[model samples]
Target chain A: MSEKILIKGNEAIAEAAIAAGCRHFFGYPITPQSELAAYLARRMPKVGGVYLQAESEVAAINMVYGAAAAGVRCMTSSSSPGISLKSEGLSYLAGCDLPAVLINVQRGGPGLGGIQPSQADYFQATRGGGHGDYHIIVLAPGGVQEMYSYTRDAFDLADKHRMTVMVLTDGILGQMMEATATENGEQTADNRQEKPWAVGGVRGERARNIVNSLYLKPSELEATNLSRYEKYKQVEETEQKYDSYLLDDAEIVVAAYGASSRIAKNAIDEARSKGVKAGLLRPITLWPFPKKAFAAAAKKARAFVSVEMSMGQMIEDIELSIRCSRPVTLCNRVGGMVPDPAMICEAILNANKEATA
Target chain B: METRILIAGFGGQGILFMGKYLAYIGMSQDRQVSWLPSYGPEMRGGTAQCGVILSDTAIGSPLVEEPDILAAMNLPSFHAFEKSVKPGGTLYYDSAFVAAPGTRSDITYIAVSATQTAESNNLKGLANMVMAGALLKSLPGADGGVIETAMKKTVPERKREMFDANMKAVTLGRAL
Candidate 1:
């Protein structure tokens, strides 16, 4: 119950972070997401929050790690190249099991690609983005309303799992306008549950909380890895949320999530008009991957086309979910190019052709 | 019904705003909508573009590659997206900026002297609003009063002076 205003996704994320009781933000200026830093820079001062524009993405993420180790809600955001630079920090945070949020408002990738909106970073975000055997809880928000809602959830999930949470979005979603807010006034989220391991010398009678991943003994590292894997499994079972559209009696299902789902929906509409049964399995949470819902979808769906802006990142998960129960095809466009509804519809029709003929 | 529109211009021409207004109108008309802008090195003092999708159904993609409508405010925008306009779609361009238009046999091309008309209304920096006006008028299936109401809703409530200039801009733009 709050007043509505047309706010950009980037700005809404920043504000939501503030609302979620996050008091520290560290980032470098990057296009399509710079508004995130700009909003924090302007407001972080008044609320006693720490906002620092580091020398680079690497430096910014490390600052996030430093703040997170002290048991505070902290975040860092960057573009594709900058996210690559922060990969080292991301991996370290995962190893330490620190609760932090990272926003990747993605643009064209592989190198210093163009700054158009793209989901090319899907593999980078989902499949253990950094090095080693670890995963960050990634959330893909498709619109402005979800942008605000997901930011609050991202912060909460980071704390809940004691892991890094990423808001994986494209530049267009970051820059678009919409009218919705989770809370009326800022500083409204009452998330300051007392923790014994918070920084500041642990107060009077608190256990020393060590926030590092430097386990020398092989047995100790293996034990930690086992625990983390169990936790990740629990997350998969409990929190794999997604949205299904027109899938009850659909023949051709379009498996798309994130920004790509927007285009896929239009294509599905066009295809449905032409008597083709096309539906969408839009993943609200990207990391957990929503296996159960999609498994149920596969029982009814004949063929699923994994539509993406990249080659085939999420398709791997879709394939893994179905386990060859039905045909899985790919419809992708890369290099910062957004595929049109006509192209996607053509791909769906082609999938239909392959399914029947 | 869904309409995908692409508005393009050189930087600082309010191309993004044009798309935003369309999206606002779409929202007011109880339609699902998205307004996506070009952000990066390409938008900072160079050619800028924004995609607006207005649909009765849920919107999936924020960016449209082959737009149903092209509101090109300058020459580069028209030249770059003239071919990308869907067959039988509409192209609303600013005659003040584009001296020569491409020959497209399939689409309806409307060349309005937008910047000049904004100048006539004592609004020099409103070529984009004019383009929005022309788009609102010429777009085959858009709600008429929804856009005008959204235009009135554009300015912040505290800044009444900004309201007059924006209304003047929209009016001059509509005239074009």
Candidate 2:
């Protein structure tokens, strides 16, 4: 157990990464997420860790790939535009089956939109941000506490799956400050275990381990892709996580993730007070999509409203999860603006009206 | 019970710090607290504001569109946030810098010359603390002693001197 301290979300993520045995952090500074890099700069040195501010996001993520290939727990963080630059490296990491954590403290984007909170990176994160038929395990944390816990979970999951794990959070979650409890000391790294497949030249007996994504032969590439898909399926079976609130008799269920989910919870509570049976399904694991939870929730839900801090990205997933048995509506804000509880509550009311109408 | 407060002022006015202190006080009392600031290029001038939510239950959203209490330290902030305070909520503004306090019939408005008081008392940068003190006084459930103790933890060790000055400002503001 650790003492509770008031810390910012970005700083909490950095601290939790340290606790999770991550010693190398490479990142390029960007708006709404620079605090994460700054905190790592100050704390990594104190812990004798390597904290490098790379010249750009591309260089930083590649540095992460290099360190990860060396069998060390390494990470990189950036906002939307920066993460876009790191997409190539992220795809490479996924293809190489390298265990690394990438934190996306997201801001508004299609291009260089704005630097306020926005969950507009859903498709990019869940559907492989780079050019590949690959997927990164994306964890969406709704608050400061989840920011800490999810970051720590990211390391464990990355190592477990030998895949790139992303902590998908918006600018609000990154900048928000809250009371959080962190473990006292750092955990031991698992370099020795990773050494089996690590890129360090054959030590004595075992064959050399090559960490790369390039497959010259078509059959070899197909086999690699198939194996990755198999692992992703296994992940989908085991890693679905979500928080279900007031769903027992919920007629209208609001599906949301990360920051939008936080606001949706408030709307759910408000709607319930006014005799509206509104519930929430907050996806913690965005990549796994928590299909089972939604499948179960769909049994009781009459209508659904997908709340997001974007134009609407997760709504498609919600529609697919429920198989269009119930109508799925959208309640969203875009370009770095967060929707208020009142707006979301109205969306719930509209969903209910449509369901009854 | 929950208290959703908005503290707004210029960047140098310690608006973020004011929200932090309230959050720290809530944490000291073992309550759930969240403080979120508006950051980006818009933070050009000292035009910064933060939303602080202190709740007995889990806090759903850190964003408080309509705050139970709105504390403004400058005219821009006052003008920007006056209408956002909930009906029958409390609005506390620093009269030293803000020239006009809008007339809102539903909410109770308190205008304090916090900057002037801090200046007169030779406590130059304690204006935010004074406003914070007034905020604490308005909330009946908050404990002044807990806040003072939390202030010790929140203030950095190197800036130990400012803690005393802040406490002094808090004490004076509470009296107002």
Candidate 3:
């Protein structure tokens, strides 16, 4: 702890990005996540980093493409709709095997969705939104602190693996008030390691590093994807994190992520007061899915309830994880809605009652 | 036992900060606590609310529909969530902003002109903290001393002036 103060989640992420040595930022404004873009726009000029609000999401991603080709630490962010426009650029980034950070402060969407928070884009993020057999390091942050930590990690991991990394967050995590002033986040604006690959005047010192993904052979593309997948598996193995609350003697466990899990924790508290042995499993990494934790918890948990903002995206992961536990149940609110704790408590009570019966 | 609460008001009223203060004190007291809010455009000078739960057991949900208590700072919030308060639950409101804070006979409603009192104290921003002190007066198991300490935890060390004002506001608001 450096100095304690309260800061919104988006501003924290921006400060973290700057501390991580990412000097170039390109983005289009979108709701729920606009605070990040705005923060970058205001600060980047003072720090001598390039901050451009591109004409559209497409243009922002393309600018990222150009910067990353030069091997510079660069980034761009958008909401779900803007993320859709950048899909083509994402595929291009994957094909080229370049490193950059992309942020999706997801809002409800299949199309121009409302500006409230939702996790419907989980499929889009984990599966790689564009048409390709490629992969990107996907990180999910549930709160304000991770909003800062993950952005820094995304940059480090992207550079280390020489691949793209996306920070997947919801509107709440992007916009919520959180205590981050104690953390030394001012470093985000000042840290940038030298990248020989970045585009700048070479001054006859060495050959220019050309960035391209135009190899015509299918085998070449397949090899690139395989290498990327291998890197992803390593990330999953070492980088996965989830939080457990009062599960030691719990008979029923509820699984939720991001902002939804916090609500679930409240429900568990309520249910336990009423004599229901409920607990919560909060996944910090949505892509890795924390299958092992779910498997371990299933040893004592009679049943697991998979809760999310979207109906069933993470439910698929939960169902595949536990072998002997009661069938997983779902509690959700879609189209920019958050699930209520009362409903969660009811589900836990009902599930516990059914198990007893 | 679970103590789930919802605190709601306009943006400047410090409702969110009140929730944060409760959470901090709950944490210091070794209770399970979480603070959650309705963010984004709704956070812009309009009705802002936070759902907080302080429990002795593992927390299952963070959402507080039919919260055990409500701290409604303004009219819109009272109207939006009044029906959700549990029977026998306590409601603390600033009579200055909320003219008719729900007429439910089952719930205990404490109306205080907190904003007016805070303005009179020459600490308008303290209106939120004033109402917060009123909550300490009304709610069971809530202590004024503990809440004062909690307010210190919330105030940034750099904003020491804000602390005296907030404490004074709390005292002034409590008298109402």
Q: What overall lDDT, based on C-alpha atoms, would model 1 receive against the true structure?
A: 0.83
Q: Write the per-residue lDDT of candidate 1 for residues B40-109, one digit (tens) a residue.
A: 5766599988888888776676777779989887787888899999998998888987878569889988
Clashes of each: 5, 2, 23
Winning model by lDDT? 2
Number of the top-ranking candidate, with TM-score as the measure: 2
User: What's the true lDDT of residue A50 in model 2?
Assistant: 96
lDDT of each: 0.83, 0.88, 0.79
Candidate 2 deviant stretches above 4 angstroms: A187-193, A201-206
Measured against the true structure, the TM-scores of the candidates, in listed sequence, are 0.91, 0.97, 0.82
Global CA lDDT computed for model 2: 0.88
DockQ of prediction 1? 0.61
TM-scores of chain A, one for each prediction: 0.96, 0.97, 0.92
Question: Model 1 chain A: which ten-residue window has the lowest total lDDT?
Answer: A178-187
